[model samples]
Target: MFCFHRLGLRAAAALIVGLGIATSARAEFPDRPIQFVSPYAAGGANDFLTRLMAQHMGDELKTTIVVDNRAGANGVVGASFVAKAQPDGYTVLMGNSATHGTNPTLYPDVTYDPVKDFAPIGMVGSVPIVLAVNAKLNVRTVAELIAYGKANPSKLSYGSSGIGGTGHLAGEAFNAAAGLDMVHVPYKGDAPAAADAMGGQVSMAFVGVASAASMLQSGKIRILAVASPKRSSSLPDVPTLEEAGFKGLYFAQWYALFTRAGTPAATIEKLNGALKLALARSDVKKAMASQGADAAYTTPAALNTFYRSEVKRFGEIIHRLNIKATN
Candidate 1:
């Protein structure tokens, strides 16, 4: 009995030691380089912002953060990769409006749940979508465009990045709100859509600020109104759709950081803190401005709540429009 008691005591001590080691390991959180996955092609807004944020976050965390581009299937490829990654803080995804907000409704075979499959770190910022027309479309303001469309049914056609994209939804929403009958012209991508719009192939288009920067600068297209609630600093002269006498057309492009579900709360807080620090830097703000994006950040809880609302909002739009993803 004495020997058994001694052995039991030893086992308890070993168990305590093991628990201590596990706690320490959890506390060590980002002891090694982190892999930041950008679920889009290189040179796009998502990739650009991810690289910049990774650099700044790496600086704050005092560790290396490598950006891995996993572009395909309209962001599902990279999103799935991150969804299946370990719950450790080492692997994270740069989630945007499509991945966490609308993909579930758009794609019938989405592999992960936006709210359940990952832990939201925090929001990076919002990229505003612009409603632009060809330079020589002969329409100056939203009112004029509406009047023209009303007079000529199906004469006013708008282009989008692709079918069922945010741009398409925005155009449809705009048509419904303005009481106009405008046709939607889907292109393969933003470049071609905006290009055709600039060349007068289409009457107008809903374009991301980042993708429309050059077009705005080169006088290729004339912006009618911004789709966001507030006007973008990049185009201070441009008015929001509300300011242009059309309300409830507030569509935002949300970008944020996220990790797989089951990540430790402490680790999520640490990453959120690092992201806040990086977003507050002057250089980071400048980069965002150059890309026609705003520097915005939110707490983890706030992000989770906002993400859910976005998913619901966009999901409704997708359902009502009957938009389906091809891939």
Candidate 2:
């Protein structure tokens, strides 16, 4: 009887040890590299910020985070891909205003539902949109550009990152407020739109400040007014569209991180924590600021609420403006 009792105690101890080992294994998430999808072309604000966050977030999570560009249909292609990906934390997406905010209403056949198909990780940052004209046009201020556009309506045209992007809506708002008929041109991303504006392919380009930052120094494009309620820190000297006599004109491009929906709540929390840590870093914040983006972070719930509100807001704006996707 004594021998049998000792064996039972030993078996119990071994069972406890085995259970502990199983728990430890389960806790080990992201043992491999994570794929970070950026739903825009490289060199744009989204791509730039994604790579920046990936580097720091990967360090925090102790895993490799690869940034993949899947550019098409104003973020539809990449967003849809993420929506259909396995609900593991390994596959993530750097979603932005165009992908989560305006695309639903703009694209009639978009495959993914922004709110239902993905879980929100956290907010990244936002950059104000600016109206920049080619330097060759000799337009310096909002008033001068408005006059030039009015005088030569046929020659005046505005380019945007894409048909449903915030830049596109900003251009439409400008057209309505100024009573001008400038043609709307769409490009794959903000970088291309800004580049074409500099090359005189378009009279002006409505783009995020980050896309226009480097080009501003080349004397190729002259920013007339920011399409935001206040001046952007990146272009502190530039006037807001409201201050430039166009009241109620405000547009900003925001970014965030998301994983496929139905991911374990614990995993989402873990990823969110890493993202918060990354954004809190001084170097990351400084880099984002230098590129005209503010490194903003929020809880998963807060980001979801904000994203839903933005979708509703953009829907109303698109409806009122009668904006239609050209692509």
Off by over 4 Å in 2: 6-10, 28-32, 86-88
Cα error, residue 316 of model 2, in Å, equals 2.3
Candidate 1 — which residues are off by over 4 angstroms? 1-27
Please give each candidate's TM-score. 0.90, 0.88
State the displacement of the C-alpha of residue 24, model 1, in Å, after optimal TM-score superposition: 6.4
| lDDT per residue as tens, model 1, 188-294 | 66777888888889988887776666676778789888998888888889899999888878776668999999999988998999999999999899988877779
List, residue by residue over 29-142, the lDDT tens digit for candidate 2: 788999999988887678889999899999999989999999887788999999999997888999988889999999879999999999999999999999999999998898
Local distance difference test values of all predictions, in order: 0.86, 0.90
